[model samples]
Target: MLNLTSPILSDGLTTRSISCPNYSLRGFVNPSSKPRPLTAKPHQEIKTPHLSAVAANATEPLLFSSRAHERDQKDRRDQKDKLVVIMGATGSGKSRLSVDLANIFSGEIVNSDKLQFYNGLEITTNQMTVQERQGVPHHLLGEVEPEDGELTAAEFRSAAARAISGIVSRGNLPILAGGSNSFVHALLAERWDPETYPFNGRGSICSDLRYDCCFIWIDVAPPLLFEYHSRRVDKMLERGMFEELAELYDPKNDPGESWTRIGLWKSIGVPEFDRYFRKYPPQKTREAANRDDWDAARKSAYDRAVREVKENTFLLAMKQIEKIQKLRSAGWDIRRVDAAAWFRSALSSPDGDGGSGGRRCKEIWEREILEPCVERVRDEVFCLGEKQMTATYY
Candidate 1:
């Protein structure tokens, strides 16, 4: 069997390897041999062995042997072209799952989230914090263009395709994770013949690269999902999302550009939150209302803006679901995993009087939702990389 704990290390992290069905019934191989505990090794290069994809189906294969694996690695080309598509609506925990999956499979994250592709809107876009990233390498986050140009779907696919190739060439998985339906659809879509149909689409599936890609669709129960989104927006506000929007506001822009200072003003929460920044002017309005003995009026306006954001975001998520169905219709492989299960699992954990309970709850969430979802992907898709598969969770 291949050794994962050898000299190869990932920026002070271990890239745990998995075995086929024989390694465990679930296709996981825990590297029992411990290498020297990793210390700070900044600027050190990571060396990982290339893993070839074995034939996948109902059929079983021989147990892993070093000689056999080495020979297969030399002869086969499938392992060099694996891709993980982490997608779903906003508030469904796509970012969290991508981070966890990348850690397990020694993968890098390629951001396809359209808003995340821009700069200076990190909090507004719900960009994953560095601490939340868990030390995995992330590419294409905040890769904006000069002069605030409008980024087309094709442009993003080109960038993401390059990033995917580099990750695979390094013997690591390439995880395309985000909720940008347009970008995801464009990247995985069937190659279009522009001469035959110039207007339909110019999107390329990049089939020339021979990637065996599968979509891990993270979902949340609708009722619970709305609550999740509301709480998430509240958290964003607490973290100064309002201030971020205020900094980017410009009343002189055409009413058509009511979103923000730049072209990406159409991002999910931006348009909805525009009211709070423009007409409502929360803090200023509050002070003025205090003089008139109507401070609650300012609070009411802010509350209305928050409600609109929550409702509009829900509508946006529903539209995304429709778009995803179109991809499913076009025969893209997708696996659905529910995030409400994780949230419920976390909430159901024992509670305490202090913030300790909240921290412990997050631990429960990782153990329950995040880790298992990645393991399932390892077993059902990545380990058996040749299958065109689909599974649904509600």
Candidate 2:
């Protein structure tokens, strides 16, 4: 039997010794008994006798090796390219966590959020700023032009596949991150029959994945998530979301610029503000004079639009959560990390307070969400214990 004398090293090397009863070296002869004098001259090449029998019996020890050999065989049999997928609702910090994991794993992110595919409207779609990305390369983010029209799921799968291949070629992990579960489903599903199983139909999107996936699902309580979404909409407005939309609100540029049309205009905030923009044109024409009585009406319309944006955002979060649940039910081994406590603490803390509340919330997030996710990803990449692969919420 082969016995591991010490713990397996972190580098996967083991210090093992074989212990067997009546196991002798078959042809290991004692050179001392032969009394062969070393008569070789200095710096001369010495020829030693080859122990062919001992060399032939070298495989005997391995035959009695321990479970480590079995484990190595299993790893070889199941070896597949690894992929990390980060999924969550709108305000659940999926983008932030993806960035963190990519940094940890020497990874590059391939965005799956369909809304974030278009150029401009960064605030409306909540695309990560270059500064916020912290220099980690991101793919398919704001690469599509507004006039280029909406990208289909199949098209996204093709583009994302190329990006993933490129990232893998550069010896980096590919992290598929965003709230667009449809794009993710498109790219990861092994066999998708669009005709028979329509995207929105009750078809089972099986998890016969193309790559070995480590799915990290960030979950927040619905009440806390809704409250967080409402606050985030207000934050977006403060960050000049309205002004950004105003710049893109040129109905004269294209007759098909309506929110109902397929394209960047289909974003939640863009459509909701359509009426407000019509009532109060961003650039008032000289022919149009503003009356004092219209001021109250315009303000009311603007406030109503903001309310609708918040409501629509909440609904979108709900739909994203439902899709994630469906993915879990469809045989995907998704690891869920609960950030509801983090959200509650963050919501209670005043924004820009520069106090311990903000720091404490960050601590909670790292402990409850980020650290667990990092551990899970580490285990997957290293082919560690199966106990770490359990589908339990952290």
Best by lDDT: 2
List the candidate 2 regions with Cα displacement exceeding 4 Å: 1-55, 58-78, 196-199, 253-260, 285-294, 352-357, 384-394
lDDT score, candidate 2: 0.71
lDDT per residue, candidate 2, 1-394, as tens digits?
1111111122111111121111111122122323221122222356765777556768654353668788777654454556889999987888889888776656789898988888889999999999889898998888887776677776776677777766765667788999988778877877765444423666668678777788999998888888887888888888989889888887654435453466687788887886777877777622343334456777688789999998998899999988888888878999899997788787887862112465788788879888788778756653434442233222
Q: Give per-residue CA lDDT, model 1, range 121-236, as digits (tens).
A: 68888888889898989887765742356566656555666666567556566789888776775555445332332223453332332345666787767777776677777778
- The residue ranges of model 1 lying beyond 4 angstroms of the native Cα positions read 1-80, 145-147, 193-210, 257-262, 280-294, 346-368, 380-394
> Which residue pairs in candidate 2 collide?
none
| TM-score of decoy 1 | 0.68
Relative to the true structure, how large is the alpha-carbon lDDT of every model? 0.60, 0.71
